[model samples]
Target chain A: MVLFPGSNCEHDVVAAIEGLGGTAELVWHGDRSLHGVDVVVLPGGFAHGDYLRPGAIARFSPVMAAVTDHAAAGGVVIGICNGFQVLAEAGLLPGALQKNRGLKFLCRTVELRVETARSALTTEVPVGTILHVPINHFEGNYTCSPETLAELRADERVVFRYVDNPNGSIDDIAGICSTGRNVVGLMPHPERACDELTGSADGRPLLRSLLTAGLATRPA
Target chain B: MKFPVLVEVKLREGIADPQGATIERALPALGFAGVEGVRVGKAIRFMVEAPDETAARALVTKLCERFLTNPVIEDADITVG
Candidate 1:
């Protein structure tokens, strides 16, 4: 896990990873280097005061240059909530995170409909399966030009959509992947939902998928 | 003469605005009472060097299309006076 300024959930995400036998590193937003971390995560919170757009100003942070470079080399990038917004702003991913249709800070667990099972991230999840993840964002709506949205749909780039459409995202998208699903930005907090019966445990499958992906890449 | 054009960019009806909320929370401390319904929007003020309002509107539209809003989530209204 990387800690950007204004990030309030790094510790929790780190704890979740730690509980899962993974070490999470806190990377400050000011640092320009990635420091040998295998996976880069942009945790949720308000960054650069969420100016212009939710993640607009933060896209220019010195650390992002390295992040973009790392992702270009097929490194995994996971952005949650505001982190997702930042990914879109950085153009590492297409589309934009718009304000939620209700115009309120919605905080609750919602069901996410898994749209694809091909990505390394979603290899553990079956397509069309419903998983519960807590979403606490006002700018969780995903939007792109109709042509782009259509193309994404045609290309299987859309990995998930909120089953309930909590936010008025284009085509009700809640999660998306890059061309190869190597990089994913999700508005829901999988870290917050990794435990079943805890209301957040529904997120464990996604995290579990990360480990599964790492294992798949290990030397045979 | 400088004409002040209002370029209000409000979150599309239901967009979440944490920045606006943070500012609103501080307004009471700043003695801004009766400031109800304070939804923060972006107002960009730029002087257009066009020959006339029609040309200005066209340029602004292009700017809006290419840069201002994503066209999928936001709608920009360009008015020249």
Candidate 2:
């Protein structure tokens, strides 16, 4: 996982992965290498004080060059919440996240319907599977041009859609994958939902899917 | 030459401005009238060093396009002096 200065969810993601019997590590934002990790995760938090905009300053962090290289090499990259904003700002993903429709910071569990099972993030789950995930953000409303939206829909790159449209995201989109299908950005934090003791373990399948995908591409 | 640059960033038309709308909603309660189309944005000010005004404007415009604003949802209007 990549750890920006203000990133608070790195530990949560590491704990979640470890609980599922997977190993994880943290790479500082200033570090320029991913250390050959097959899967790169940009955890959620207010990086760089969310200066200028959420994820804006973080996109220029030295480690992002390495992240971009990893993505371009077909490695799996996942960005959750503020990480999603970073990916968008870095041009790793399409569209941008603006302020939520109600101008309120939402922190709650939301139902996310898996729209497709072909991408790395959802390959282990069946389509239409509803995963209860927690989202915490003040600017999670996803926006994209009409052309890009049509392209995303036609290409079946939209991996998840909100069942209730909590933040007024266009097309009720909660997650999407890149054309290569190896990169994903989503507003919800699956790491926060990995334990039944916390609330739900629906996030396990998603993380498991990611780990499985990573194993497939691991250098043996 | 040092030029003072002002960049006004606004959400593109047709995009929802909830912050502006929320502020507008409270206006009627305050007995203010004749208010509509409330939208919110930000102003960014900086200084750029260039040989000429044209060069300064171009430099600032590049900054606006690449860093100062997100063109997907916001447009940046630049004023250089």
Candidate 3:
């Protein structure tokens, strides 16, 4: 887990990963290395107090240097919620997360549909499968240039889309992977939905899917 | 020399701006009429230390593209004084 100073979801993500029989370690934003980790996750929260913008400040964090290198090496990187914003700001992903169309901080459970099963983040989940997850953010509406949107469509990089379009995101995109399909960024908080009592257990397959991908990338 | 920079960031022309629309709708209810094409944007002020005005302008422009605004969906107007 990559822990930005203001990130509040690191523990939640760590707990979820542990619950799924996966070991997780929190790496501070100032850290200069990934410690040879298999996968890197940028969890949710108001990083750098969301100053200037949600992820603008956090993108410049030292740990991001290692994260960038990891992604370049085809290592798995999943950026959730605020983490997604950081990835977009860092140019690791296309487009930007603009303020919600309603201009309010929305916190609620939402339904996401798997749009493509080509990414490691969603490969276990069959296409068109709907997963219940929670999203909490004031800026989760994703926007990209027309050219980039076309490229995403052509490459089939959109991994997930909202079932009901909660945040006015273009094409109802909830998650997307990079061209190489190793890096994924999404708005919904799958970690928040790992439990049956609190949220939903639908997030299990998604998290497990990452473990499978990590195992593949593990130095053998 | 050090120059004060003002960066104004606005959403792209075609993007849906609900906040701006909401404010526009409120204007007529407040007895203000004929206010059309209302849009909302953000202004950021900072100091830039550069060698000359041309360099300062170039720096601000780069900042606008790199950090101050999302070039994909927004445009930034930068002024150095």
Against the true structure, whose lDDT is highest? 2
TM-score of 1: 0.76
User: Which stretch of 10 consecutive residues in model 1 chain A shows the poorest summed lDDT?
Assistant: A211-220
| Alpha-carbon lDDT of model 2 | 0.93
Interface RMSD, per-candidate values to 1 decimal: 4.6, 0.6, 1.3
DockQ of each: 0.22, 0.93, 0.75
Per-residue accuracy of model 3 over B29-52 as CA lDDT, tens digit each: 999999988889999999999999
Better of 1 and 2 by TM-score: 2
Error of 1 at B32 (Å): 24
Show where candidate 1 strays beyond 4 Å: A214-220, B1-41, B45-81
Which candidate would rank higher by DockQ, 1 or 2? 2
- Least accurate 10 contiguous residues by lDDT in model 1 chain B: B1-10
Q: Tell me the native contact fraction for each prediction.
A: 0.33, 0.94, 0.78
Rank candidates, DockQ, best first.
Answer: 2, 3, 1
What range of 10 consecutive residues in model 3 chain A has the weakest lDDT sum?
Answer: A115-124
Kindly list the per-residue Cα lDDT of model 1 for residues A42-141, writing each as its tens digit.
Answer: 9899987886677777777889999998788777788989999889888888988866765677898899899998665688889988888888998887
TM-score of chain A of each: 0.94, 0.98, 0.98
Off by over 4 Å in 3: none
The clash number for model 2 is 0
i-RMS of candidate 3: 1.3
Clashing pairs in 2: none
Worst 10 residues of 2 chain A by lDDT: A211-220
Model 3 RMSD in angstroms:
1.3
